[model samples]
Target: MAIQPDSAPSELAVAEALKALGPPGLLTGCRRIRGGDEQFLLPAERDSMATRDRKARAASGAGRRIVHELLRRLRCEDVAVLRGPLGSPMWPPGIVGSIAHDEELAVAAVAMRSPSVRSVGVDVEPMLPLPPDLRAVVITSHDRLGNLDQGIGGRLLFAAKEAVYKASFPLDGRMLEFDDISVDLKSGEAATSSGRRLLVRCTARPRILALAYTP
Candidate 1:
């Protein structure tokens, strides 16, 4: 279930979110990076924003800054933020990572000591009602099995696909469609028919979150 923005925030909330992250061992010496909203206001981010887009840009920039600073604290230097071939954010060499942000929340995962961790992708989307019309395009016929009537189920499917796209691009350098990956809406999980498994998680409220890692 997704956490409602209206609810009171607490340490338990953070822990609950982390718990949904699946096995920490899968991450192997991985660390969680947390940052407040202020970190997104860097000059570079500000410069890229349109005058009317300042608010949204600032929020996003602060989230990225928070994650970047957390990386620095982990001793990741020469931190260059580049764009991948698909235009997703790229990390410096020797780093595998995933990032998620929604409203006031942003979180990132980094593997500091894992040599085998190669491709990584993370995505965060708010828990809310999705348009009914687009569901067909995003949710394939295969995904319609098992409780497709629920709105939360649909959101999870959408989020899993987004995460798969993020994680797969670095490995295949190709754009993937919702149909390319099959999602189990009931479990809030996804897997590529080729054998890649992504752990999909969601809060009861409506947010869809996922992370994919390739060794």
Candidate 2:
């Protein structure tokens, strides 16, 4: 969710946005997260990882905490969000979720532990110009390149495609590059490879946020 003019980015705002989606089992949250120790990790999560680096540990801690907090609110039992072979989150049985973290912000969205929602994804990124080296690979000629002159379009496109990939991956289990999905920034929607369409809703305040939900 986008931050309100009166406030900074926060969990309340994101929760409100998820509620507005009107899905019975959706729970969402965002945090200005920091790294911590093994205490933050569930036994299963701590044991499965191969890395012992502090920064990696901290990022994992923050993501798990945000997820647990939302489940706590929903009164659901806490379960570890393990790492899948492809590096995507392996949500517990009966749940569909997505998580993304940048240097300073971590955001997560989970469809209430049920079979109804097949997948859910949320991504947040700084509204900066796309780095030069990544331009050709991510931004296609079909996109409205004119927005690049103004500076926010490329980042939005990258973020939207990321959100779409996360939402679609569980079904297809295929990795997607930015060029794989085409987005209409003006409409906040993307064309999916499987002939189904995924809606990409975006909000930009301190950063750009895109959330995708698959049917």
**TM-score top scorer:** 2
Q: Which stretches of candidate 1 lie over 4 Å from their true place?
A: 1-16, 25-52, 113-117, 185-189, 193-197
What lDDT does each candidate get? 0.55, 0.68
lDDT of 2 by residue, 64-169 (tens): 7777766666556777777777778887666778888777666778765455566777788865777867766777765543344524677767777888899889
Worst 10 residues of 2 by lDDT: 1-10
Q: Considering every candidate listed, which one attains the maximal lDDT?
A: 2
Stretches > 4 Å off in candidate 2? 1-25, 113-117, 142-150
Residue 74, model 1: lDDT of 61
